[model samples]
Target chain A: METDKIHRWHDMGGQPAGEIKREEHDFALWEKRVDALQVLTSGKGYFTVDGLRRVLEDMGEEAFETMSYYERWVQSVNQNLLEAGVYTIAELAERMEQVQARGETYGECAGSGE
Target chain B: MPHDHHDHSHDTDGLSPSGHPYRPDQDHKLTRWQAMEIAMRELLVEKGIVTAAEITETVEQMDRRSPADGAKVVARAWVDPSFKARLLENGTEAIRELGIEPGVLKLIAVENTARTHNVVVCTLCSCYPRNLLGLPPDWYKQRAYRSRVVKTPRKVLAEFGLELPESTQVRVHDSTADMRYLVVPARPEGTEGLDEAALAELVSRDAMIGVATARHP
Candidate 1:
């Protein structure tokens, strides 16, 4: 508390307004990532069929009797992106960095002292 | 496919670039590692990021091509019933007899039966028998394929132009860590009397998926 009182906190009104805008963008980016990841299987995990099913049961999640939930989600993203001329694997990596950058900027402004 | 070095000493009898038909790199069916490497090399050259000479070290880094190893083993298995039984039992060791590495770990060969066809998919990651089958397909790496294969292999296969008869069974091998799979594709009927080399030619990679049977007369 004493150390906090000693240092001057910068005014962040202008930046905080921009922070809200950045948050919206960050959410949009994450939506795309989730959209991308959900439809497809990067097959990069401890991803076993039984294990996934067990988790669903444990969480009491509704069993979507279709092809595993995220698998089709990922494909839909790919198909959509492909139709849009941007369905390649590179989109995931590119979106991730933008998401992180937006998140950090938002956190910085949100923590700024009044 | 261009062979300018040999052609230089020979004929001037060639026409327009018919010998080298323009084709998409992805359509080339080159191994993913090779394709990716070639793409990277071309990109670097185009961007002037690396000189052409600097690419030499990266060029020779390929380990092997596709399942020429598995094909040899399958061909031998066709000729030798004992070997077929052994292959059905232990694929890695059986494949090793043909002097083909079955990859670094234990490999499993699941037979695609007449009643039911099986396909393998590693839902979590791009886990594959790189030493056996070489690099996997780009579509294989897509989360779409990995996610749905176990839960909806038949449906997925249908999309890939595979159809199963109503009487046929469809068991999906959800490949996980410590295990890898290759489909011990059923031998086609018409090619029964063929020699091992001829049989090997018919044992195409897609046959391993139990999708399209090997090309035969």
Candidate 2:
């Protein structure tokens, strides 16, 4: 579920993700996490696979198959992070702590040596 | 400073006696277009074109793969004569042996010395060695840094607190469409007893930019 305005962003990409009516649901929170509008406004987000696929299609890069949309999205997002001037040793330490917590809460990470 | 798009050559502008922009073509030069591009990027961010969190996540992901330890690699080469030759012949592989990835990053290490100098700038769309350096500094992308770093390298380096000798060659690296540059600054004096981390401490960000030399700790 997404707000009407946020839904419009997905719709504008030419292929909306079904009818997402505004409701207090987990998808609403996920929508917030994956909101392209939010990423764009932040001046520091990357493109998503589904989201990037639509953007690539919009930019006529539909043939690009070298890397997944996820990888592409990550690249731009990393650039924005640097552009935002937020990487210091202390800040990085805190971020690592978050990852450590995420590993504990969620399933084992890709390289956590489960 | 508002500058005419055309006639960027410093010679014609009557600023420098040399026909070239204060920095050479290889050196990074900051111009109005670059500034506008930065502004546009910021605007896109504000308009939800991208987000900060995503970038941070990407960085965390990449850090595990290819870490940036350019200082360590360069310092090793400076001390070891054989490795220096190996580095010159094959930069990517030599650095990769240290666990820095060549697959994800495109790096060009230029040696800086009394006779030869190397300066770097991401001239076209800010193409950088992301895997190696994490994220480039704001100054690396700034038009002022890009343009001046190449065109008027000596002056720009001075601003960054670097003063080179008159005879020292100032080779400005314009990171145009292709690759990102890392300057292998010559070893400083009184650093013989220092360890790798101590040497790295002297390797300032500006030193990598090629405007300044690494200081001895």
* Predictions in order: lDDT: 0.49, 0.50
Residue-wise C-alpha lDDT for candidate 2, range B1-217, written one tens digit per residue: 5977575553465333322232221123322222222333333444554444553454344443222366677777777878777777777777777666665345678888779878776543355665555445444543355444555767767776778888988887666433567788889988889877777777765676676788767
lDDT of 2 at A64: 28
Candidate 2's C-alpha runs over 4 A off are A1-114, B1-57, B62-68
**Worst lDDT window (10 residues) for model 1 chain A?**
A17-26
lDDT of 2 by residue, A1-114 (tens): 454464322122222222222111111111222223223434333433234334433432232224322234333433444445533335544444444444322222112211
Docking tier of model 2: it is incorrect
Please give, as one word, the docking class of candidate 1.
Answer: incorrect
Superpose all Cα atoms of candidate 1 onto the true structure and report the RMSD in Å to 1 decimal.
19.4
TM per model? Answer: 0.49, 0.49
Model 1 DockQ reads 0.02
True-contact fraction per candidate equals 0.00, 0.02
lDDT by residue for model 1 over B1-217, one digit each (tens)? 5755674544333222324222222123332222222332233344444444443322222224466666776778778889888888998788778777664467787776687687776665555665566545445544456555665666667776678787888877656557688787777788877998888877766567544555665
DockQ of each: 0.02, 0.03
Q: Write the per-residue lDDT of candidate 1 for residues A34-90, one digit (tens) a residue.
A: 322321222322133334333433332132323333333333433333333432347
